[model samples]
Target chain A: MAASNEFRTCSVTGLKVHLPAEALIKANAVVAVVFLAVGGLFGLLVALTRWQAVHILPAEWFYLLLTAHGADVLLFWVIFFEVALLYFASAILLNCRLATPWLAWVAFALMLAGAAIANVAVLQGESSVMFTSYVPMKAAPHFYVGLIVFAVGTLTAVGIFFGTLVIAREERTYQGSIPLVTFGALTAAIIAVFTLASGAIILIPTFLWSVGLITTIDPVMYKVIWWGMGHSSQQINVAAHVAVWYAIAAVVLGAKPISEKVSRTAFLMYILFLQLASAHHLLAEPGISSEWKVFNTSYALYLAVLGSMIHGMSVPGAIEAAQRKLGFNAGIFGWLRKAPWGNPAFSGMFISLVLFGFLGGISGVVLGTEQINLMMHNTLYVPGHFHATVVAGTTLAFMAFTYLAVPLVFRREIVLPTLAKWQPYLFGLGVAGISLFMMGAGTLGVARRHWDITFSDAPLTFEYPPAAILMMGLNGMSAVLAAIGGLAYVLVVVGSILFGKRLDAPDAERPRFIPRLPTTVAAYGSAGTLHVPGTIVLVTVFFMSFVLYYFVNWKYLSEIWPMR
Target chain B: MAITSPEKRVWWNEPLHRPEVIWITIAFLWGLLMFGMMVYWHVAGRQNLSNEAYKVFPEKFAEKVEDMVAKYKVREEGATKIPVVRPPPGSDVYVLSRLWEWWPILELEKGATYRLHLSSMDWQHGFSLQPVNINIQVHPGYDLVLSITPDKAGEYTIVCNEFCGIGHHQMIGKIHVVDKK
Candidate 1:
């Protein structure tokens, strides 16, 4: 085993001859990881401010931080990371380089400028608008312009992604079949295209409204279209999360699912139905006709959920099968025994999957229901649900992938392995604790974004049992733990980026392996691989979600509600 | 990483065969059971506490409004359940109508079933019950009927939950759940 240090330079072709596809994506991912870490801090601060018995910030400052948190986490952190992943799959994973390097730089510059504007406006007293900022709750014009600018940058980024795909197709690099990871990323990019398109549609008008160019914009219409952008972006997050999961399990663990086909098809389903699922957010809103609500909410969303549930069942099934193959004796949790708990990547993935299922998935389904939305709408439970998904699910997965990504891409070794090993556990436990506490408080009728609960010198009126107060306190403790865990993650990641050792050779070489089963089979597995028993169950679920949408609309939107 | 050579098995490939299949099935069944219990508990609790039998809307005061036709006689929409003016504030019914506004002029009763049918003829409004923190949407085409039963008699504020407009923060309604006069 000889360590070879060779400096590779640009060839006559004007591209680095030795740079691997994985290395490029991983490099892009590093920038995304840093941004996500900073944005997550803002997220944590906002949560603290919101949950503190008394707000941590002055009334005015509280609103500013709120704006920053939303802009950073919701818009910048998630989307940028997703874009990096998109580039990774399209260019590197698909054996191609970015179509135009200059366009990528332009996208980055515009996003950076937009983020600066949004942040500055937030810090200034001019933009105190809440994250929703729903028209008429005016913010400074720059804030809206900043949002528009950022969205435009994202559009350019997306154009580059498609360009890569076109270039890849033309080169015939994806000759046989698309890799599962690329397939998943392609689906996410498609979602992003629609998502960004909706953003341009809504935000340009909003920017004009902020500038006083438009005096009248119907709040209802803005809301409907806003979900097309806002909620659709979240769906992109969800799709990217699943795609990342497959990549981690297969690439890192050398584990292929029972079938690739099932996974790929599920990715397609996500593309088809994710946009429609946005109606879940508006289930309890007023003035939407029953027909429209029913069609979008119950029918379309349920189909998307069915796709999710299929993945939900199949992913774990595949993992269990993989564990058994590792030669662990068959017991209830024998698979756990064989699992590489010491490995940071494996542990993070494990914890992420568990939390995603137990917390995020369950909360999403319940909140998606029509009648249930009545209690849950605008409650702390709403944020709690998303936090579980975005932070615990997607963020954790990203952190886990970083264990492999940092070394592979930046040629840097993690500074402290021991700290790195425990980072996931600390963070995972803290997130789970916080989410649970939030869920409990939500059950007790805790509202969201209220500056003060003890209103008008009246005693704080609450209907929760005595136990719920304890839960709220627990929620506070969980917030503290989460803050600590988040701090640790930042330290570890930043330490590695700045001071970690450079890799020599083995890591530089892309390890070769046999092709797994076709993604279609890997997706669904031995069970029909297409029209399995699970498909029937999925169809029923799709219809049920469809019916639920109509039932809620019919009950809530009727001119004369049956209250006699 | 690139695939250089073909191998018999894929990297860390996990195949779901009979034994693994049986175990997954059992675990899924257990999950289903737990899910069912959670659903049952949630539904049962909501149904019992939220039904019309619990209380009526505007749990504070009682009112007897004149018929729409006569303006003097109590309008007979129908006569089934006797009008129970809880804490029996008065016979004068205060019907205040305002969108993006709240009904502050009201006398209340303790544990009285006053059918508070909240509706907005224009844009959507939110009627959030004070103390309980329960908020419902009020739309032009829809009426949100609430049964309010105040366990304690006191002055409480009803805040708007929906973002009606710039005045949403100030759109506060008052309800005095007075002792029987």
Candidate 2:
């Protein structure tokens, strides 16, 4: 039974914020940032080592750091932030108390402990088995145990989220259905459950095998089941980040989806078909039938891709519609030109949307094709594709949300506003460069996760094209630039939390977070006639690029030695 | 509106915008096209991954590779002692992947097709043929047999792209596709 005093009305957004939920969000977010810093540093080291010219770190440290980099960033940082998002979307948005605050704290403690244990195991030099672990290459037993513990903790937090949702419904916190962002969060949570379950199924057996209790862990079976968790976890990211895209549109521009049905249906498509895309990883592997590969990799005729395409249009369309209504109606591109590029939140979200669609979305579809995968499997292109999706798309979107959340959730004025304004572009451009260069190198047959692309110490020598080595050098430079941007983000966020002015204080001046619109402007269904011609043109360009790239990959495949 | 509940309770009944309808239709059709292309490629395309795989013991697979090497070893590759075996056209060729090397370098005549058998002795390895740019996942205990036709004559490098261990970068093999007379 939480007291009424435990809730405070936010000065901005006018949403009722639960104190416990806010604290939990803050704690989870801070820890997520901490992991991001550590992981980003490790990533920089890896990129430098991969650069043929620099070639820093011995072979042993390269693999070790690469493993740690993947774990800390992909698993710890992203999942921790998602847990915070789950809580935010449920309790705070619903204007209800978080279900079992004590239990939520316990979940957090377990996650912290799990993350620490995994890090320690990796640091102990016994668990350099990379993030996929791909059994038969046994890591420390504690590595598996730590991951299991982490997954259990995440599962507990998800339970609390669902419980809070129930409480919100029971208490009748608001009218009608849950908000679209919350619905999107629900989609992510559902996917998370599936992901965690798959992880438990594979990892538990692997843990036993690591301790010598089990023998003959089949490698093929490990990959099949492992990707069930591995790739599905990424699906969770897709759903969550799309939700953030929607949330940012609402907060920044007070924009509604052109049609709730259309948007919600797109999210529904993700839940139904996104997990099937995991088959792409196994497309080049044997022991899997071509029938299974074709069916699963296409996601039953690319319905999930259709879902992404929908978001690709609607997100920008929503923004365009909102801007048009605000009288930025000079031409098809006027609204975009007049957009709030100076605001980090708006700029970050917009950059994320565009780059994600162009670089990540297009490349992913091409790479996932069954035959096309033969050309790019285990290449630097794989990492290039993911950096675009996970880092540029999801992480940038999260950073944009943080710009809003710092003031709204943490109730602190952002420190170093000037640096914050430029952070997104700096980070976004650097990441885009990394993705492009890595893919370029991969196109030239540069192997990923190898210590030396030059193969300086190999018995039989092979030379990569000079262009591939050049791409690696550029990738290393981009990584350094991205690392600086990451550092700026950490400094701004931490500095604001510790030393910036408190918005909640009675004496403090509250800056208007959400700009006030005209009285006549309705919040929903106000974009009459939906004349988003700009977005239409944009998506058309995207379509053309996709068509070009998809066919180009097939052309590349055709040039390879004939195989069947 | 995304942050709050919908203004209408019956939100599903709302009409979709014309652009959304058009985009969805185009996107769905594009998806179908992509799917059709993959299926069509299987029927018409020359390059397709072979689904032929078998379960075998590591020791047994190693023995087969040794047999292939003994029967067809032309000469030792310069500097490295790895045997470069030239199997007959349309023969079953074996290449075993282990901790740090792809053993028994292969030689084939251009325009000659052969069933290439690949399996890892331990752990999983990626058989990434460079210059030609064909890659496949090789797993222990499972022999993946790909039908390979060297259409062009050149020296090809087999790069072990999968991270097997510390010596992964050093694990390289060669394939010589001699021109057909």
Candidate 3:
């Protein structure tokens, strides 16, 4: 199974490297992409069904597609890509051998098994808990079991990745500090481990209960505990996005942050503080003390967001410094004018970060607040907010990273380079459109997880005004854009796998061109390695402001420090 | 320890004072804008709701209910509480019905713009208006308030949106919108 002569072994943490870890990551990413498309398809279908009140599929089939969409895109596709990223960050970037090749494969196998089981269960019409799996509404026992086993498998994968990271650090894998990309991924894995642990608590019990092992059930308690599992999973996804940002910054733009210590510290903060951010979801739920939600949101989530914001500034800071070094002196904005926007890698990095930081980031903060919770809770705005972050921010970042991973990891040349360039625009526009529609519909009080509004007795009518119908139509159009963009991704990836030029030459023979921004100024230093003390202090002061706000606003605690 | 030294720094490092401030300010401004928008939406939503109770249904249905209630009122020895007058097609009415729990309940009507104040004494209940698909969350301590006007006339089915244990799905209510003669 080990193809010895084909790939080069890393000197950092010596283990015989047969398959390029990049290829494994790419192959897995392809799988994730396929699942993402399926999820997107189901999302569009659900939207259509809700809008028109047409039963496209029977209840069983509808639920199956819904379940599959949640598992595949939200769960399977996202986690698989994160795993691929873990391997890249730990092994490939650090020039280290994996801790155990067999363990890596085992992780992959278990993930596949879990995905297959979940998919089959959904197809057979057994499990449909609407992704969150709130208690009392039980799915088949196998469904819960499958989810548990799947989570365990993914956690094991996290363990293996962590093992590689630790060994590389101890063994002096690289000459200097760990690369920023790897650091981001390291944080993501740390967050994932904790998040998955929450899943273990709820799924196991839910599984046991489903099999009639536990007769009595309290829905309220179950809801409280389940969110510990449920909400943290989203935190892991956000962490993955942070990692992708650094990866794109390095791999695509060949730009390194100005300060390694500052960047890594920000990532470390994300690792430590990300879990508490789950309180944002529990803001409006009854039984949870308002004080708890308030503390969680402001203290934990706000800190994590602060970490994200630090990185947000750092990403562009690195790019700007890098551009300066390259002698692009038009102005601060001149570097942007001069930078290589045409390159798929550069564009992806820039667009994903911009969207994640602004649109997604703002919505996240508002949702984290107490007063805003009354309006946005469980409404269409719920999906509106997530699609901005998960789909637009994290997923888009992964897609951009794929442009690099496909070639390096998969050993396949990109088929249509130009079309690849067009994807971010289309996907971004689609997400924006969908989010607006959902936000507007939320204003009109639309709920999620219902087959149709007609199913409810709210006396809602089909005769929507021009603005509402326009919003719905806009959402549909955005779905169309998303489909096209997703198709473009598949075509480039799959086409390269089947027909593109395969590099049979040695590692040295491959072209090594990490594209740089067009305009380069030589101001402070290489953005990759500058010491920016002032920025760090500023961020600290900014974070402390939130802490100060929390102290004064105890009633405001539910928004941040949620207990439920 | 050696790698951590400042001497090992790469080329692109610079202070982010300018960008950081600019971005944070932009975010703050956007936050204000959203808050403004949210306030507008809340007020607009409230304005759209009606505070009036049961408006007499269309011309046809109002006449039938009036006739039926009047006949019952005259036959009874003392049914003084019964309302028998032919209300204008636009007039409002309020009444009570026992839901799945056999508790006294009051519901709002469609098209009859009325402020329906609903509450359950015994258990948690869901007061959902059919055809409109608006669900007013109901609980023991707090009174649920909804100002609604049903645009369409029909038999609207109301089911509980909340999980209130067994027979939850069977919890149903009706709103009769009488047509004007």
Candidate 4:
């Protein structure tokens, strides 16, 4: 048991932070960043090789590094960061001690060891089976074993999060439905459980097959079960990042949700229907019935997508309502214009929200459509779509939240304030380019994971449109820019923790971590009829764009060769 | 605030604003429209993916491809030694995807329809037809059958988009659609 004195009152938020949970958050976050750096470098190499004009790596290295890049970034960096967020939402926000501090440390150690083992297997150069690791193409046994260990570790961390929630409730830490942020984290944790179980069911047999205990894993079955884990993991990201969006709004602007019932109901939709989206990956695969595909891919009438659309409106609506209450009510966009653009936390979160809805959300729905998937399955467009969602959306949101966490949780001031101000825009712009250009190239029918898009040296020949090559070149340039932005973020974050001014001592003269807002605000319904005409206008624009893009894809499908 | 517990104990009973009600209704209507389009396309659209698939052993699938090649081989494609098989209109055409190559080049009439049978001999592969932009997943032990009609006359390339192995990029096939006499 931790000592009662282990709690520290945050000078900024006035919340009691459990010291053990804080340390665990710090450790997990640091490891997550390290993997991000490693994975980002591998991704740069992949982009350069695909550029064709500057094809740097040989064929073998290209496939191997692509595999490494997917695993490290998609699995290691993202999951580790999510674990840290679980602690921050539960133990830290609820103002209670973490359940089983020793067990939390064990989880951390297991994750580190597992990541190291998996990376070693990949680097050893035989197990270049991409992230999907589709069957009949065998990889080293350690690859599966490493991933299983990693999943176990993540599962344990999720268990701790649930246990801590119980602790908070039993200790009567606070009142009234455990805060909206904690509820959102609870949504992520539930999805994580389903995802890990799916991973175990498929991977264990694959592992046994690798070691000669089992034989002949069916390719169709592997794909069906594997996507249950793969796609659900991204859903976990959606829930977590949406929570971050709400958290940033609250911390930066002291914004309360317009209606708790509405927002929470949207999250409930995700829990019920989001996992059915695993069918999105299997839409074009053989041996799957159209009835099954239509039912699962549409999520029993696109209810999960409806959930996202709700968040898309409410997140900004909350911000607009808060800004208006602060007397920024000149026009429709006055709330937006008067927003704190200079603050990295606010800027990053806002950028994440917009890019996610426009690029990721739109492209994902198009690709998931059963008939339209024929034009996109296994194309570079698939990666382009996901990069927008995971990188521009979830990752940027996480990075934004870090700026606030450094000061509040880590007890350190930001080291390079000027660089922090510009990092999100630079990163956001570069990633947007990557996603757009890759999708452009893919629209011209360029294959993904191909070492040579030109089909140079093949017995047969095929020529892509000149525009496709141009898109790859532009994508390579964007990757270089994103790499610089990524480097700026790492330096600022790592340098701050090590050398930035500490805020440990109870000095009244200390600088504020977040901008000061009025302490006493009007209660939810009492705040004189919340008017958010600005948010409504923005959502309308979004709706129009979505309608246009959706029809354009159907037009593209019509131009393809007649098939059934 | 989202970071703190709601001041009201029974927050679920709170009334939604006018804008939210309007937006949710619009979004749900849009969702229903998108769903309807997918179902509508199957009935009326020319371009649609086939859900007709059958499970078979790799050996049996290979034998079928060989038999088709033996029956329909016209000539060896220049320098490559792969047979360009011209199956008759409305007939079953088999193309095999192996380790690093898609075997047996195919030639079809521009206005003729044929049943195309695709399956892999080893790992899973993606059958990506360029220019026309039709793509489908091909897996071993599963024969994916598609009824394809070539509406335009030209040469098209089948690029293996899935990552089969180190030689995945090298796996390319061809289809030559001749004009109807």
Top candidate by DockQ: 2
Query: Highest lDDT: which candidate?
Result: 4
Computed on alpha carbons, the lDDT of every model, listed in order, comes to 0.59, 0.90, 0.59, 0.91
Task: List the candidates' TM-scores in order.
Answer: 0.76, 0.99, 0.74, 0.99
Runs in model 2 deviating more than 4 A are: A512-514, A523-528
**lDDT per residue, candidate 1, A1-564, as tens digits?**
111122233211122222433443554565566566666676566556555463466555555676677777777877777877777667656656667766777887787788778878877877766667666456788888888788888888878888888887787755555567777777888888898788788878888888778875665667778788888888888788777777666654455544554555567888887897667666655455434554566424355665666566555555555555545546556666666776677788778877876678767766665545665666667777877888888888877777765654555677777877888898899889878877766655565554433333322232334555566556666767776777777787788878876554543432111113222212323432322233234334443553454344334322111111
RMSD of each: 9.0, 1.3, 9.7, 1.3
Stretches of model 1 off by over 4 angstroms after superposition: A1-31, A50-55, A299-301, A456-469, A505-564, B1-101, B105-126, B130-133, B137-181
Which tens-of-lDDT digit does each residue in B1-181 have in candidate 3? 1011133555134444444545455434544444343334344423222222222223333344345354433222111222322233333332222234312122323345543444443334444443343443343333333444545555554444443433343445544454543
Give residue B166's lDDT in candidate 2 (0 to 100).
83
lDDT for predicted candidate 3 compared with the true structure: 0.59
Question: How many clashes show up per model?
Answer: 33, 0, 75, 0
Provide the lowest-lDDT 10-residue window in model 2 chain A: A519-528
Q: Put down candidate 4 lDDT per residue, A1-564, tens digits, no spaces.
A: 458899988887788999999999999999999999999999999999999899999999999999999999999999999999999999999998999989999999988888988999999997999999999999899999899999999999999999999999999998878888888999999999999999999999999999999978998899888998999999999999999999999999988888888888888888899899889989888888888998899988899999999999999999998888787888899999999999999999999999999999999999899999999988999999999999999999999999998888888888898999999998999899899998898888999999998988888878899999999999999998888888889998999999988877787334333788776445544333668888989899999999999999999899888999
Model 3 CA lDDT for position A528: 33
Winner of 3 and 4 under TM-score: 4
Candidate 2 chain B minimal-lDDT segment of 10 residues = B11-20
Off by over 4 Å in 4: A508-513, A524-528
Residues A295-341, candidate 3: write the lDDT tens digits: 67653425566667767777776666556556665633666778777
Cα lDDT over the full model 1: 0.59
Q: Give each candidate's interface RMSD in Å.
A: 9.6, 1.5, 10.5, 1.6
Model 3 docking grade: incorrect
